[model samples]
Target chain A: MKLLEERIRQEGLILSAAVLKVDSFLNHQVDTQLALEIGREFGRLFADQRITKVLTIEASGIQFAMAAGIALNVPFVYAKKKKAVTLTEQVYSASVHSFTRQETYQVSISQQYLGPDDKVLIVDDFLATGAALIGLVDIVNESGAELAGVGCVIEKSFQEGRGLLEQKGVRVHSLARIASMSPGEIHFVDDPSPAYLVKEML
Target chain B: MKLLEERIRQEGLILSAAVLKVDSFLNHQVDTQLALEIGREFGRLFADQRITKVLTIEASGIQFAMAAGIALNVPFVYAKKKKAVTLTEQVYSASVHSFTRQETYQVSISQQYLGPDDKVLIVDDFLATGAALIGLVDIVNESGAELAGVGCVIEKSFQEGRGLLEQKGVRVHSLARIASMSPGEIHFVDDPSPAYLVKEML
Candidate 1:
């Protein structure tokens, strides 16, 4: 987590008041070594849980989920944004509103991929408005799968993401929590909670 | 390679003449254990190349690329299929036509990710028409990166994918090469090459 926070500080580009571009290492281009480290850490944190599968949304979240799957030695399934022709008509679909894109798009997972017997952990690159995460939880619920928890590389705590998930009683773990950010500086909130302690350690 | 062949025969679903659905273990729901084995095989095969980075296209290719990255201890970069707010204006973009989807889409990689000093090994789930593979190759070329080769989980050799890639002078290593397939039966191509034989020994 420290390494991730450090990388964010060193390589993460703050594009605006609400956007942080991590194309150098996180989303567009992946730092696989760091991803594995983060994955192993998540595996350690959720070792007690019965994680049958790791679920996430497509594009950025796939990398982190893949890394966690490797560390936990569990299969990872990602919901696709675009409906491919191979996907069947019977699917677990949810609409997610992208704040950046300013558009709502449907994310879906085939019913055949998930089942009632599975215990799933959701993973993603960033937690902003928590729309994508909510969509993932919806898909998981549709499959009758148990939602173990949610894991994210970075979470902007100043946003409504954490509060929304907390309202639903979903346990959220983010490697780095940004309380506030401006230009080249980022501030962290001081707390003894697990998420805060993780940030403090970072 | 035998493990992969056996997996295809046992678990892969031939939905129709055009679609071979391996969603149970490959695309939709990934088998981390098998992915790790496939990763190790790729590592062993491309071990001599000294690959600097593993290049792939999102979101299906991320898992296999991550597994290979873990085995090789190298970073992996996946091309983004859509233009996000975080991406820069200047990028190496290429059009990829999806046979499954019956549509053409743009796949782009940032210039910062690939460069002349980097040796990129392209990884993907399936090599059907080789459109995605060639798109990746174009991105790598635009960045002036060295192409180590291409690796695929399954190759439909009868589909002209291998021949197209070969025409581009890119060496491709497929775990399971299918000569042909149908709803009733699937025929696998004989591994006449030494590399495939070595992969089988693994």
Candidate 2:
């Protein structure tokens, strides 16, 4: 997490109070080594759970989810942003509104890939409005799968994302939790609890 | 490549003469280990190219591009399907027509990530009509970056993807080259020139 925070400070561009652009190394263009390290961090955090699969939305979240899947040695499923011609089966879906794109789109996963037998860990690049992550959680719940937890690489703690997921009793962990940010400065929440980490056995 | 071929034989659903769905393992629900191996295969093939970066389109191509980036120990960039608010700067953009979706969309990458100094290896999950891959190739060319070649996980050789790319004088390598497929039956084109591999001198 320290490394991630440092990288954010060095390379992350703060466009505004609400916008942090990590396109240099996180989402648009990625540092593969850093991504692998982020995955290891997620694996360590959720090591207690018997995670059967990693789930995420398409495009941005795919790399982190794939990295987590490698770390956990499990398959990762990404919900499609659109129902393509080949996706001709019953699906578990949730409608999500994207504040960035200013649109509502349906995210879906085939019923054949997930069900009651699976234990799901949801992962994504950023946690902001919580709209997208919440949609994934709803899909997991609808599939009758057990929700292990949610893991995010960068989190906007000032936003309502963490609060909403915690309200659903979903365990959440973020590598870099931005407390506040402006064009020239940024702050990260150095929470003592690190509540997302599963407690060790006595 | 044999491992990949076997996976397709066992899990791929042949919907028609053209559509072969491997979502259960390749795209939607991804097998992490297999993906890693595929990346290693690509790395081995393109070892001679001094590839500074790997590039692909968003969604389906992220994992494979991530995998290739890992194998090559280089960063990867995925072109955005739409221009989000954060992508406010000047960008290298292309229009790609999706045969399956029956629509054309603009794919763009931040100008900050790519330029003349970088050597890039383009990667993707599938090479069908080569529409998306060609768009990426054009983006790379527009950036003034040197392209090593294009690497695809699966190729429908019966289609014009290879021919189109070849016409551009672009080197193409696919792990599994399918000659044709009909329901339960599939054939592979075993080419003598596996040109991607770097030759060794005694």
Candidate 3:
């Protein structure tokens, strides 16, 4: 977690009062070695819980989820952003609005993958408004699977996503939680509490 | 490679004589254990090369690329299918057509990641049309980086992708090259060449 925090400070760029760009290391160009360390940290955090599978949404979340899965020795299942012709099976679907893209898209998981006995740990690169995480939780519920917890690489705690997930009784753990981001400056909260860890950043 | 071949024979499904579905283990639902093995295999295959970075496209390709990156102890970079707010820097862009999605999309890579001094290995889950691989290669060329080779989990030899790549003098290694496929049977090329030996079947 400290490694991730240090990396964010060193490479993360503040675009404005609201945006922090981690393209250098987290999202665009990945530090795979660092991701493995982050994954091991998450594995250590969730070692007590029985995590059957790690789930995440497509694109950015896939790499981090795969890292955690590898460290935990569990399978990782990613919800597709779009439905392709090959995806013919019935799916557990949810509509998610991307604040960045400024549009709504459907996120889905093949019904064949998630089962009633599975305990799902949702992972992602960042948690902004929590719209994506909410959608993932919806998909997990639709599959009749139990929600183990949520693991995130970086979380914007000032946002409302954490509150939304907490209201639904989901445990959230983030490696680095930003308390606030201003012009060229970023602050982090060291508390690991699920509630403040996700929603109190602003 | 043998594990991948066995997995395909046991869990892979052939659909309508056209589609090969390994959704249970490869793309949709990823088996981390299997991917760990794959990462080790790819690392071994490219051990002699000075691989500064592992390059791959987002979504499906991220998992295998991460696996190989971890195995090889290098950073991995994934190209975005679309531009997001998170991606604000100048990038090398290319047009790619998705065979399964039936649409053409632009793939972009941050210019910050690829450089003339970097030696990159392009990786993917499958090779059918080779359009994605070509686009990745184009980006690599645009950045003036040397491409060590292309690595694929599965390659459909019946398709023209491999030949096209080979014609361009890009060495391609596939874990499993399907010589041919039918409604009920999937045939793997029994003997792997020197180039194929580096490739494994997954």
Candidate 4:
């Protein structure tokens, strides 16, 4: 987390008060070593839970989900943004609205992949507006699976995302929690003793 | 490679002569250990290339690209299928026609991530029509990067993808090369001594 926050400070571009671009290393162009470290952090944080599967949306979240899957030694499922030609079976789906794109799209996963026997841990690249994450949680609930919690690589704490997830009683953890940001400056929430590091030391 | 071949025969659904679905393990619901093995196989195949980076398209390719990046110990850059709000800078773009989706979309990569000094290896889940792979090759050429080769998890040998890539004088390697497939049967090209395996034993 300290390493991730440092990388954000060094390379993250604050386009505006609401926009933080980490394309240099996080999403567009990825740092494989850093991604692996992030996965280990997630694994340590959720070590107490018996996670059967890791879930995420397509495109951006795939890498992190894959990393978490590697760390947890479990399979990861990505919900497709649209139904492709090959996906002909019955699916569990939820409609999500993207504030950045200003469009709503249906996210779906095959019914066979998740059911009452599964324990799901949802992961993603960013947590802002909480629209997509909430959609995933709904799908997890619809599939009759037990929801372990949500994990995010970077979180915009100033937004309503954390509040909304907390309202639903979903345990949420993010590596880098941005307290505030401007055109040329950014701030992160201070944590003197992080839980993952404490666990690592023990 | 034997493990991958076995997985396909056991789990892959031959939807039609043209479509073989491995979503249960390769793409949608991914088996992390298998993916890591696939990556290690790619690493063994391209170990001599000194690849500076790995490249692929968004969504599905991220997992394989990440795997390859891990095996190669290099970063990866996934070209965005569409221009997002945060991607405000100049990019190298290409248009790709998807035979399955029956539509053409623009794929773009940031100018900052690639250059002439980089040796890029492109990885993907499938190499069927080669439309998407061709688009990525063009982007790599435009970026002035030296392409080591293109690696695919599965290749439909009956398709025109290999022919097209070969015509461009690009090296192509696939773990499981299917000669043909139908409702309940699949055939693979027999290779008694794979080149990568020979290199590994040496």
TM-score of each: 0.92, 0.94, 0.93, 0.94
The candidate scoring highest on TM-score is 4
Residue-wise C-alpha lDDT for candidate 1, range B1-202, written one tens digit per residue: 9999878877776666557778778888788889889999999989999899999998889888988887888989888888988885588999999877778999988787789999989999999899999999888888999998999999988898889889989999999998776674677888543221111100
Model 2, range B78-153, lDDT digits (tens) per residue? 9999887778789999999999888999999989899999999999999999999999999999999999999999
Which docking band does candidate 1 fall into? medium
Q: Estimate the lDDT of model 3.
A: 0.85
TM-score of 1: 0.92
Task: Name the regions of candidate 1 deviating beyond 4 angstroms.
Answer: A190-202, B191-202
Poorest stretch of ten by lDDT in candidate 2 chain A: A193-202
A1-202 per-residue lDDT for model 4 (tens digits): 8999888877788777898888879999999999999999999999889999999999899999999999999999999997877787899999999998999999999997999999999999999889999999999999999999999999999999999999999999999998887666677888533222111100
Q: Which ten residues in a row have the lowest lDDT in candidate 3 chain A?
A: A193-202
Off by over 4 Å in 3: A191-202, B191-202
Candidate 3 residue-wise lDDT, A1-202, digit = tens: 8788878777777776668788878887888888888788878888888888999999889888887887788999999988855677889999999887789999998998998999888999898899999999999998899998999999899988888899999999999988887755677888433221121222
Q: Which stretches of candidate 4 lie over 4 Å from their true place?
A: A191-202, B191-202
**Candidate 1 local lDDT, A50-168, one digit each (tens):** 79899988878888887899888898898988887667558899999998888999999988778899999999999999999988888888899998899988999989998999898
Q: Model 2 clash pairs?
A: none
Q: Score each candidate by Cα lDDT.
A: 0.84, 0.90, 0.85, 0.90
